[model samples]
Target: MAISITQFASDSNLLNTPLWDKQSEILEEFWAGNYAIAVWALGRRSGKTLMSAIVATYCATMLADEYKRHLRPGEKFYIISVANTIDQAKIALQGVKDLINGSPILKPLIVRETTDTLELRNGAVFRALTASSRSGRGMACPLLIFDELAHAVDTEAGNAAGSSLYQALSPSVAQFGKIGKILLLSSPWIQSGIFWDLYKQAASGNFAHMQVVQAPTWEVNTTISAEFLEQEKARDPELFKVEYGAQFTGNIAAFIDNQLVDAAINSDRGLLPPLNKFNGTYYLALDPAKGGRDAYTACIVHYDGELVVVDQFHQFAPTWGDGKKTQVAVSLVEDWILEQHKAYGFASVVLDQYNSSSTIQRLSGRVKIRELTWTASSKTEAYSKLRELFNGGSIELYPHPKANGQIKNLTVTYRPNGTWGVSGGTGAAVDDYPSALAGAVLMATNRINKQQIIPAKSYRTW
Candidate 1:
């Protein structure tokens, strides 16, 4: 029989330090062949990538023959480390590379290496790739590590879909029977997706062949201090709960119905242009970026009597400076808005008065500025109006995947201060698009209300 994972690491000198107690237990349990599936809902900075790398290295080296026996004569055995994106997958791949480089025994086994793949002399192949159902098909995989599985959204579908990828890949491990293992590791997210489904099954004590481990960062990584966790919680309690406490936030909930958002999208239309006759009014709405986390967003919308059309959507990305300071050029954003105004001649420019004083001052003489003082009541009203438009099927959006995804991914939290904290999901998810869309829809609704109230203006186009 092949040596245990811990023994393989020791013989090869693969790890710089010994595995933590929980990490050792995880490997030990997996090696005991009690489970075909292992789910790790760990907190951030819990050394998930390093642990996954160790598993991959051991499978590629020690368990090579056992896995290959079921394969065809020349068919390669695959060990895949896939994540939400290629860059994230590469972190785990790099860890494996570092281990092999540090080990005299394992280093010689690498017959070939590339940026995203490793091939051993014994015909074992290791690959790092982005999540896709098409990519995972027909491979003879004995070990598959799905890193950050909670965040694995279907980029191709332009919606939150992970089940298809899971269904496609999970079956590839069937040939090896008990020897085949699929490991999923991620920080806890919303109570959805395949990861959550498996976690629930494991927790229910119904799936005897599935093992699940859940632990906070502080519990798993002893070096993380209480003071640091305290600071993180003070900064953003909901996010800290998910990122460090390993808790699925019960407070944060999906804001918009995804089916409603999907119904509002016009897939065939891509950024409609302004009308040539200029008979109707155009509204320009802006959501300025506060910092690096968000993109500066603007939307140009046209509301006829029956339909609301988003003519254009603009997003300005930030440039990173030293120490990772992000600088989004306000002047560039101003210029783009002015260009849109030159084309559409917007009747009213709507924007929140938060972090936009300078922009307002610059456009004071150029356009009609309708400033929204974003109090708790104002935000609730705006988002509610946007949701109303979506549910009514009166608004149409173009095929912008990121913007559409943002709208679908938005979540609402009722805070202790009696305010609705509306946001996109944590960690790289932003609400800039949704914010601008809300502003535009709010303005459109007000225009319709105003037209109805004034008898004389009822006939006029707006």
Candidate 2:
């Protein structure tokens, strides 16, 4: 007797509850025989792993039945699950194992079971593997499920292993005069990599060979509480978009969550006034363009006893001209800072490590300028701290269209070693504002309540 997926899942622990309507839709799509590829950009806790496991196990078991009855001898088939790490792979493997175990009629067919693979009486196997160059090879499998693909690291064991594995499986998937399927399931991340590319291609209807299903957390996982989604929204709006809304953030991974940036933007204030008479310590940070071609931006932050607000944001042209011309650009920046110092007392000036040495040399005695070289690790740290400040609602932003654009352009990248890198989005016109803001955030943590604000001076030394 042929056991249907419905029979195996009926009254079982795995499907004891009613299937979410969206899950039914996905299962129907998989069995529709219309699409060769399925791309799932679903939110967290949407039961992606569970759904994938059911389909993988059912297909492997059912296909083994076909091979046993009608296929030629010595032929092998497989259903393989691929994840970015061994731990992640275990998730898929565990789900499959549980479903196979919970089914009353399906348990007897398993001839052998290892930590990562299961072999049936027939020459069929169900395996879970990682996204390493050495993994997922030599398997002439029919179906492959990629779990949480956005975080798949490159340069692991040399080269892009995920891409390599895809090439290896593609031929087999299209062989045997039978249609094969590939499933890509993940949460949203930055707008890069295979996940984004394939999704866009499919959605555009440009690739008839691909199919996509994009759903928010609530739409797919009907069991989840609205309160949980609300909490995530409150915690970080940009994060909520990725986790619940299932939307691509931007070009690069946004380091500071969008909700934080949104919360900080003060719509009441347009561009900050040229100067202010506020009685707070002010810190100015400069990220200058190497030449006048790029943007040279300075951001000033005011710290009262308990609150921090961006009081002034300015962008200068790229480093301009020869010695004299360069000096003029320098004079413009220096003069502006000095004047702001008079309007609102500035305690210390923070300089980007790669900023102009000439300008620093010229302003040494006028104000305390500390230059900290920004490395990958240092930039990660500063951005992380800035994110923390925004998460806690500790920083306020004065509304300026350019500043808003720059802040939103901030992207974060993760290394295989688990370190983070923050930068502006690809092809951004200006990153200076965000860079300077990050520096100011780092300096703000060191400011003291009793610290002196450098008062307006009577004499000019420069």
Candidate 3:
């Protein structure tokens, strides 16, 4: 484990190479460190690929030797590697090939040939893969390397490329105590991608013995000027930060303005009224799904200015033929309303009226149903009002664990025209959470202004 710089270069045949500068020094330290996970965010043309190839060769040789000494007949040693795309995988393999071809001591390892993989002489294998096309359910590797970690997109299944790739290596490493190593190298692109998630986790002590080295484009290569970077930022501010500055920024095209949303969230104060005041008036707001797995059936409970998110129900409904599912959904809503009506005596249940009119008709007798329509103007107005209410500290939330999780996952981004929208990746909104919260605020504030309130009439003597 105490790998010296001279040993690494002599064994790998990279002593006289162009990458044997200060950058290689950092990589050498990383390789010899005791960290379980090491992240190297190298800049453009800073010889990152070459350094990675050298590291891969070193690991392959070391793991192969270890396997030989402790050989079980059926034991498999794997060097699992990943890239962003097929072409990138090929490029990574080319680096591995370069190291193999350069080193006189390690040149005989080439045993197989393909577009994206190389089989070694000592029964060990180097498998190149793209993050998007990864199916790592059965893969078990003692050594795992993820190249260009920042380019992977966020998926609905929670494990973005980095997480998924790591999950695949977990089983293999679990058996080999203190022998497994994971390497992650990338030029930072988006702030909220797989790289950022892993970095955050590693930073927050979720992962043991993790080392992070951030090599900015300028620091790694002096040719990358500040003026040139500024021009790139002017063209596309979001892309520039990720590409050159090596910063992790959430979705640049984010729907909601993060600053506005952050301003609205009152972390200091708990729910507006204490949790004991459960007898107040309450109403449910629903945002029905459009179709497919993309959308979710969201529901929220409104009690005064405090928005208590009760549940978020999501199901993929392909066939809307007779709308039987819609009716069933409405029936369930009716039952919930009746139960709540017996307790809080809600004035009226409000719902987005875009796609659920028939469902509304089905529940006419059981409760007072109000169909809420949102126009482009109205939507803008409502969002503006919600922003104001949030900034003004008028909104309160019940400290429910599920609600807190959703809120933590909530992210906002500004549009090109300076408008805002809300979104989440691991915690994206599927149902009426955002809309219902907006609706509750609007109903409390706007109902009085619009004169849409239905007052309890007095039965006077005729």
- Model number with the top lDDT: 1
Candidate 2, residue 61: the lDDT equals 69
* Cα lDDT of model 1 by residue, 190-263, tens digit: 67667788889988888889888999998888887889988676544556778888886554677777887888
- State how far residue 245 of model 3 sits from its true place (Å): 1.2
Give the candidate order by descending lDDT: 1, 2, 3
> What are the models' TM-scores?
0.59, 0.63, 0.50
Candidate 2 error regions (>4 Å):
1-7, 13-18, 33-35, 68-75, 101-111, 134-138, 150-153, 156-164, 188-193, 200-211, 234-239, 248-307, 310-394, 397-433, 439-462
What is the alpha-carbon lDDT of model 2 when measured against the actual structure? 0.70
- Candidate 3 lDDT tens digits, 261-337: 45444556543321335444454556665442334343434444444323222222334345433323455555665
Ranking by TM-score: 2, 1, 3
For model 1, the run of ten residues with the poorest summed lDDT: 452-461
Better of 2 and 3 by TM-score: 2
TM-score of 3: 0.50
